[model samples]
Each structure stands twice: as structure tokens, then as C-alpha cells.
Target: MFGRTKEPPAAAQPAEPSAAQPGQGKGRPTPTRAEREAANRRPLVPTDRRAASASSKEALRAERRRVQQGRINGEEKYLALRDRGPVKRFVRDVVDSRRNLGEYFLPFVLVLLLVQLAVSSSGNNVLFLASYALLYVGLIAVVVDSLLLRRKVRRLVAAKFGDEALFRTGVVGYAVMRALQLRRSRIPKPQVTRGQKVA
Candidate 1:
């Protein structure tokens, strides 16, 4: 005899739900086609690194202005220098000498280089070595001359234009120089008012 197999009755089975239920699961509200299309069509805001830099710079500038204003308005302590008489004259002389050197230092280096080149031909290795040595010397001279010139300018401004005016001039000069360098210009002209004479 074969083993008996049993099956569940059809009347006892649970009925499956139809697909036409309203507000059912997995049917949450999604964006409308027009809303999605409009969102996609919206203009994108540009994000420039330069703009961020500019904003940071503006904040820094405002902070500096506040600090500078405090410094200007605050009472300052000073040491009496009644005996500092001949020292001023000596300092002025030194500044004048440095300014004169600044005016002529580059030209002097160029002339020296030309003379050295004229005396020795490119075929000579000694001449080449000398030329390089002169070039290095010229570079050092330029650095020194620039520092001296800046010092001289500071002294002149301090003597003639007062501290605040000197500071303004220095800031303007620095900005102009930076701009010119960025543009790869040879030299930046001094920012002077019309009818103002420069020494």
C-alpha cells in the first residue's frame, strides 16, 4: 500500500488584496513633473573662489580699519628726546645718500656689466664666470637698494607729511606695486597728485 499525502482545503486559504487601493503603501507623494522641470530649469548660482577671497579680504580690511582708528584716537606715551639734535641731521644725511644710491644703483650695475662684457668676449670662459658673478652681485645690489630706498622714502614722508600721511602713501604705493607686478610691468610709477613734485 502507498503512503497517503494530504493537501490544504481551498476554502481555508486567505484571499489576496486587489491592486486598486487608494493612499496605499509605497505610493507617497512625489514632486509633480512641472515642479521637477522648473527645479531643473532654475539657474545655478556661481561659486567663485576669488569672491570668497574678496569677502575674507574685506573682513580683514574692516578689522584693520577698526584697529587703526583705535590707534589714531588713543593717547600715546612718548619719551622726551631734547638731546636728540645732531642725530636727526646724521640720519637725514644717511637717508639722502640711500635715496641717491637707489636712483643710480641699477644704472651703475648695468654700466659695470656692459664694461665687463666689452673687455672680455663670450668665447672666454673667464668672462662667462665673471658675468655670472656680476649678475649675482647685481641681484644683491637690487635688494639692498630697494630696502634703502624704502627706508629713505619713509624718512622723507615722516619728516614732510607726518605719520598718517606717510602710512597712507606707503599703503597706496604697496598696492600699486603689487598690481604692477601682477601685470608683469617693469616698474610702478609713484602715485602722486597733480602738480606734486617727487625727489
Candidate 2:
């Protein structure tokens, strides 16, 4: 056994520092800051003026057409927005609402007349006269009101849109408008009454 451990040989010492960093020790050349800046500062020069002009004119025409179409679209949108609520209310009232006299009056009058005729078969008396009067009046009123409503709806549609196609377009516009308005409107949650119990 050796009395003391021998040190490593001096020939096996670490190597000297090179001129470049570790990765650049090979022959690869790195770009200087000036070269990078010069590359960045180069302007994008346009070539082919005829082609550019043609494309540019096409783009300009497209933009102008888009603007014109937008204006036309905006007018319809504005009108639809303005008229939506009133039109909705009107249509709902017309289509869904009951005709108080038309639905009930005619039937009521008929029933009364039948009962009167069955009860008093012998005479043209006061009851008979009154029954006839009520029947005729109710029938007339129902007919008149129905005709009036039909005429009003027709006139309104014709005046507003001029034709069925335009009328349908208007309707679609109104529907879109109403949908937009509804989206914008905030709906409040229903409040429970004091006596009500939750399911």
C-alpha cells in the first residue's frame, strides 16, 4: 500500500477558454445587432402597379357596395325596431283575443230564440217579438265587427308594405326586431307570495 495518495497528473488539467462561447466554438457566424436592425428597417416595396390598381379598385368598389347595403339594411332595421312592439301588440290582440259578441252573442241569441219558440208556439206576442229583435241585432253586430276588423287589417297591411311579399318581409323584420328587443329587455323573476309554498 502507498504511504500517501498520489495527485492527478498535470497533463489531465482543464482546457483553456476559447474566443467564442460554448455553442459558437465551431465555424458558425452570428448576426450582429446592426445586421438585424438593417433587416427590420427595410421597407416593403410594392411591385406591379397595374395589378395593385386593379385589386385596389375592386376593393374600393366592394367597400362602397358594402356601405350602401349597410345603409339600406339599417333603414329597415330602424323601422322594424321602432314598430315592433306596437305591431306585436296589435297582431296578438287581433289573432288571440276573443270576439266578445261574435263568439258568445250569436250562440246566446240562438239558444234564447229556440227556447222562446219551443215555449210559445201559438203566437207572435211580446216575448216572440223581443226574441227576434235580440237575435237580429246580435247577428248584425257580429257580422259588422268581423267585416270591420278584416278591412282594417287588410288596409293596414296594404298601406305599410304594398304587397304580400313586402308584407312578409316586414313581418320577418318585425320578428327580428322584437327578438332583439326581447333580448335586450330584462325579465324579473317571479316573487313568491307570503302564503305560497315552494315545491
Model number with the top lDDT: 2
Task: Find the 10 residues in a row with the least total lDDT in model 1.
Answer: 75-84
Question: Over the stretch 19-112, how does candidate 2's per-residue lDDT look in tens digits?
Answer: 6656746576788999889988844655777887899899999987775554433333333343334443343233223232444663576698
All predictions: root-mean-square deviation over Cα? 20.5, 21.7
Model 2 off-target regions past 4 Å?
Answer: 1-93, 97-100, 121-124, 159-161, 165-199
Q: For model 2, which pairs clash? A: none
Candidate 1 per-residue lDDT, tens place, 1-199, comes to 2787777666866777767876666766888999899888844544776887799899999987765554333212221232123332223233323223334445666777786777576467777677778767766775665565556556665676566754543433442233223121212222233234444
Q: What TM-score fits each model?
A: 0.31, 0.32
- Model 1, 54: alpha-carbon shift in Å? 54
| Model 2 C-alpha lDDT versus the unseen true structure | 0.51
